[model samples]
Target chain A: MAQNASQLEHFGRALVDLGLINEELVVLDPDVAASTKVTYFAERFPERFIRIGISEQDMIGVAAGLAASGKTPVACGFAMFVACRSWEQISSSVARPELNVKIVGSHSGLSPNADGDSHQTYGDVAVMRVIPDMKVVVPADAPEAVEALGAIVDTPGPAYLRLARGATPVAYTEGCEFTLGRANVMRDGSDASVIANGVMVPIALEAAGSLAREGISVKVVDMHTVKPLDTDAIVKAAAETGAIVTAEEHSVIGGLGSAVAETLVEKRPTPMERVGIMDRFGESSRSYSALMAKMGLTSDAIEEAVRETMRRK
Target chain B: MLRTINKNQVLILTNIPRVPASITSVLRGISRRHKIPLSTLKRNAQILKEFNLIAYGDPPNFSGVELTELGRFISNLTVGEEPTVHGNMVQTRSGFRPLGTVIKDLRKTVLRMIAEAGSGHLGASLSAVDILAILYMIKMKHDPKNPSWKDRDRFVLSKGHAAPALYAVLSEAGYISPDRLMTLREIGSQLQGHPDMEIPGVDASTGSLGQGLSIGVGMALASKMDGSGSRTYVLLGDGELNEGQIWEAALTAAHHGLDNLTAIVDRNGYQLTGRTEEIKAMDPLADKWRSFGWEAMEADGNDPASILDALNACDLTTGKPSVIIAMTTKGKGISFMEGNKYSRKTPDAQELKRALKELT
Candidate 1:
């Protein structure tokens, strides 16, 4: 049986692991080291870690400057702040110059449950995807988060790694090979495909399993890299499956759903449906699961989206 | 004895490799690339040979010229390095002339480039020229030959609209050829309207205001972490202080105790629209920095000696970042254009001539 793991914890541990080998790896936190779990890396590598005391814009500029001076800086903060609050700084300083700055946005989407819409970030993926030379990654699970972290650090230029706050079902075992722009097909089917990322990946897989009992085949793909969308896999899935449904714990406007829809419209024009927050803000809920359910980001919603897309096909 | 080589002669010497190349090919290449006349290239090449920087292949029908040992050394030095002796004058890495002479030349270049481009921030560029000259010439520890030298001090033009000044200083410092200065703001030119990382010797690509000090803080922090002894300097416009990000960075710098970072605010009293005070009252500016825990200082920004004195006065071991509020006139050299409205105005042909005369 697969156990649940925290993506933020895996991300923090991965930074420490990478810091041990790569001397140029420097971690920057905007005063949320404890919440973001970057404290793990900060504890082991105090000299390499810089606590920026809640200034996201300054954190980004500093990251760009460090990158300009030949140090690989990973600036971490909440998605709501680091992605949106400092979007201009990220675009001008880091993306325009193509600096090797890895920006991590923890507590993304509805995962920041009780914090409500103010703390939840549904627009990060959309904003980050729009910047040129910026690679957007949202890992599916804790183990995959570690792998994704290593891959982004190894690759040059600016990258945004989106991490959910709560623990997620482990989708991959340790040492899974994670490529930057390629999508991983979790399960292959013929009737329709469900492409998702972040917390939605596990939910999509569960949806697929449920549909299998109902004599429906659903392909599940973890579309981790959002900016450089895996168009090849998307086209392949659209052609083979004949229909597609996209799921994400973010706004349907510009997250994984839009990325897949744009590709499908241009390349394959397959029948597709997007399962995500429908242009509304989230509210404080009892737990992460309750908030996600209230936002319609569950295995049932993904199943409904797939069945609706199959009907259209 | 080596005579003081003009910009044309320096261009010729640096273009030719240490290995032998035909004089005709060298002349043709330099003429075509820099758009200089073939005759001028020939004269400069001949001067280089006379200076013993280059040697003829043979006495009868000298077919080619190659850099002599001294020629290679001088050429290497021309790429913004140590000084070279030429009669009574010394050619430092900053320029081939004295500091005052180089600054006057830079002001002329800034005006002429803006005039040629037909659009640019004239007053702001002129205001920053002297400070840029002092930094590139006397203050900053940088090597044009190796712009990415790990331990070299970094300078960020946070007030990126003054690119003409930075470009003029860079050309004088040999990071770029002087002829390239004419291509300012032109399509496909490396010297963009704003400072870009593509240009040589540019540490960070900056144009949007209020973002530079944070970058400097990062560089300073990286230097501190590596114990790399390299310093980072950032220049900001006074009007740019309207941005909240500037104060945010100021607090972060002082909080980190980034002693290696020095920020200079070009208090020219004018912004894009109107007077800075009229737009946003930033009085007691130095006090604001002081309150944020920086060691605030003041300087006559247009005066090279004053700027240098203020820069030298910074105590780097105090474990606190410093900010110098350098008070400057918008159009420091050109008299008629010394007003707030000239910030974005390009000098016409007559204005360029008049400005050049004033600079002389």
Candidate 2:
């Protein structure tokens, strides 16, 4: 877990482990087995792996059907397509009746940088969070992704796990407990707080360290679960820190920023700033870091948002 | 009412008081009791006779309406007793019933239940009744008492408007009570407007079109993975073929060599707006399935025996999925409802009475 690794690889290994433990486990992919990392599962359990060939709608429907037949289906697809193409199926067939279908969306956020804007998904969290009975989880790194995959399988309803495209900075040195609808505070401070999800968690931690060195201590909270947003942690962070800044690799419109704002406005209002893509689509970038910089998703942006929130406070 | 409940029976209701209850006498009694005209009742009775309920003799002959023994039994059957709707003597040791008899019983139950619900997809229900009957009673290996049996064959009704048909068939197979059939779309009822998995014997929940085939594929894949001999059957509407997801599922099933999966398209010709031809002409449907790598065949959807035969004849050894293009008529048994513009609408009291008569 200390080494940077592909979240998709962790997902694939988790699926195989889940299949070995539970005989009712089935995996589905929409022609991205290699990229989504379900190839490992398919190789280990060939009979339980189903490849639907780039049809997200069919894959979701099949997953729902398999879940109805008492099999827990872990469907893998690109975040850009699965969150948009088969949203209706995911809503009607799976979430509506609350089936036990786990959706692992690889290439989440701007991680699929080289594939251009069309491949990079920045609205998956927004779309998936709005669906009723859907549990949305954004792991901090590969270790959390594996833990979240196991948690999703154990949870009894529809769940969506947003995964990164390539190797992400490891945030945990060992496998840690990942409970659905819970947040883990990585650093504690009373000056200001930086709440982030997915790939932004490691950057937020770095920003917290930078703020600490500058004598402006900031708390860092990894709010991986987005749907059942950790309202308790958000409120606690606001009350303790007196200021808050939210960062995510997704758009600021309806992603982590909006979720934190919505929670704070009702429970504990606090001065806040959001760090994400403001209001435009992504463009082709040479590297993930380049896209992160272009979209203002770096640790510097989080530090700037925290400074802005502190000045407002 | 009793004769309508049992299509093969002929019991008459009259307004006139008499010793032996005749068809005209029963009509006279009803007219007198309801304070309506004997002429009006006579007209309604004439309509019933045209529905083939009452065999007519010469005019003015009170003996024209014949009361068969079956009709008498139907009229006298009470709620507490075990009732037989159709006259039969043979009891199969293997519990196999004649498909024709099952179809008739299923039709009778569906017509009565839909009429009781007062609002349902009558045309689609009637159109798919025979197919469901064949699947549940003849073709599929299912145990009604043990709905969750691991090795049982699965059926998903992608064309969920025919839920009444499935409910009636499930009732006949003892998965549901005959009395529960009347609560078709009521709140908190196990039988929903579409096939919900909460209902016993319903393998999956489906109402939105083109989703059942994928579910069937999933079940087939799961069964194959489990090394079970169970098969999966999906019933689809012809109009539902317009959905792109169906073809996606078709490709998946074929690519996976899901030979245990079988799909049946109920080509009932009509959809909500108009005929399938006018909406979307899917004429080369069998060839399309074949091109998609399935063993495709066509059968008379209204004939349960033919459906069973076609289902049996499907080649699962070909390492491809099987599809049956079942040519059926919307509103199959009811004469006035067949291909009518208002076929999907619920029948009024008079229409229900007419349908019941024809069904009897």
Candidate 3:
């Protein structure tokens, strides 16, 4: 299967088109109208949607109340508050009780290249992963975003749906199947598994492609659900692939790398290297690629890291 | 498992001196019927008993409820004091307050709570203390003893950082035990240095600065959807006003015409880093409310009496939600803390001891 139309609007339109979600699904936000690109959904279902100005905390609180009363609320806000400011409510009111609220945190994980370090989310994944029973899904590109949204039609419990800014390159094929906590093996190889999520998915996939030419068949796993790290896949990859590399656009402390390593170390120890921001705030001026490269997030970096892990193999 | 306030006396309303001649036989007839369940009859007999329009029988099979002299008194009063010619009126025994001395107590409790904790948001708490005090004390009909009492008024501390004052007032009002006041900010305590509804007095756990009011608005709308008359009140910090979410809630409140909702903005002139003007200035504050279609009012937050009066007055507005901008002094007591620009600094114990010297 392949996933296409890598845009948030595409996902939103699919939600309405599939009727898997009610048109009554709301969009409550804290002032990121243009960034998440929900204007089209807002236009079609104005009554169902709301631009909740800039009160991120109240937006989540009110959304929780609305969710309690049976209306599905898709609260949109900056990744920081959707992760930080209203952190308690997300943990207590929404996730603790297992309320059916979908928190759409757009511009997540260093998506704000120019908005400066203040807007960049260095560790959005870690903040949410600690919340018990939370289902965190970080889409690799617009295609995966659409698939994740379409996939959660009947899914339950509190979920963190992380989306990035536009110009995201497509990484998955049309009709690509997305599952919660289950990693999809994008590439099959025994040399190593370059497990990746969010914007780094394509980077890892591209690295695998580059390595393939050099006769190093690297298995790429798009580990979208970072919290419940796909242990079965990582364990299997380690058992068969002999080596691994994990990458993300988040702090190395509690992001995808930690999630993968925790699983592998307990189940099956595999030589691995994590490619991410290491104890540093993000740079504001650099383009997405330049910033990622500077922070050692390039496909070249993943290839090199994978090569280093292969040495252990 | 919960013991109610002791019903030692029966309050008799005797203004309707006698039973009408037409209802006399009905009263006599009710007095002869001994098999009726008491709770069902008590709810229906309020007005009838007040006017002597109805009377109670000797005794029922249920041994749980006893008949007393007060019960006899309640059986004779008429229920027409509600000033309506309607067929019937359902009134709660513990209904809404009318704004007065109760607010004064609520306000005082907030201050006392802060002083007890020795660490808190004095500026925001002082800013909202009076309005919130008025609400718990005079405006809302709530059971402090049973904070989760079904159908009771809902109060949300949206500007959550002001939990110290809120906890203080709730404890003073008997919603929380006075003993728990000392446990604030301590590890494993229900008082988590913020408003946690898991705590007896709090309705929503808020401390992230700008999230409580919307929860209040949702609770308000929920009550309305159920067609229940329970009102919801929320207190928001002025610093929280800068968060765009407040406006979203404000607009949503107006769109719904949540007449059962009342919001109080603690319009003190300070935030965490600096004075509101130096941080993010919001002038024409009242005009902004007016544009949002909310019936806005300005009141002195420190003056208990005025705050009580203003909250009571909110009900007079025709078909709209209201926001009361309470003008207050930051760090408003114990002269040294009063108007203290550095609102967040922990006053030295020796310095605080010095500040309290004038208290006696």
Task: Specify the highest-TM-score model's number.
Answer: 1
RMSD to the true structure for each prediction, in A, is 8.6, 13.3, 9.6
Using TM-score, rank the candidates from best to worst: 1, 2, 3
* Tens digits of per-residue lDDT for model 2, A97-163: 7889999888988888888888878788888999997999999998899899999899899999999
Candidate 2 stretches greater than 4 Å from native:
A1-3, B1-102, B108-118, B315-317
Between prediction 2 and prediction 3, which has the larger TM-score? 2
Q: Taking chain A by itself, what TM-score does each prediction score?
A: 0.98, 0.98, 0.93
Candidates' TM-scores? 0.86, 0.82, 0.66
Tens-digit lDDT track of model 3 for B1-360: 012211211112221112122222332333334334444335444444444433444244222122223432332222212232121111112322222334343444454555566777766665666566546543465665566665677887877777877876676566677677768777788887776656775666667655566777766655665566677788887778888767877887887688888888777778888778778887788889989999999988776555655676676665889888888888665566666453665555575565455443
Candidate 1 chain B lDDT trough over 10 residues, lowest sum: B81-90
Taking all chains together, the TM-score of candidate 2 against the true structure is 0.82
Q: Please give the TM-score that candidate 3 achieves against the real structure.
A: 0.66
- lDDT score, candidate 2, position B212: 82
| lDDT per residue (tens digit) for residues B1-360 in model 2 | 543443212223211111223565555645554566778766766655565544445456656353232322222232102233122111122233444566666777777777787777888889898888767654566667678888788999999888999888877777887778889888889887887877888888889888888888888887887788788999999999999999999999999898889999999898889988888888899999999999999999986546765776663345989999999999898888888444568777888788878876
Best by lDDT: 1
Query: DockQ, per-model, please?
Result: 0.68, 0.42, 0.31
i-RMS, every candidate? 0.7, 1.3, 3.7
Name the better of 1 and 3 by TM-score. Answer: 1
Instruction: Give the CA lDDT, 0 to 100, for residue B7 in model 3.
Output: 20
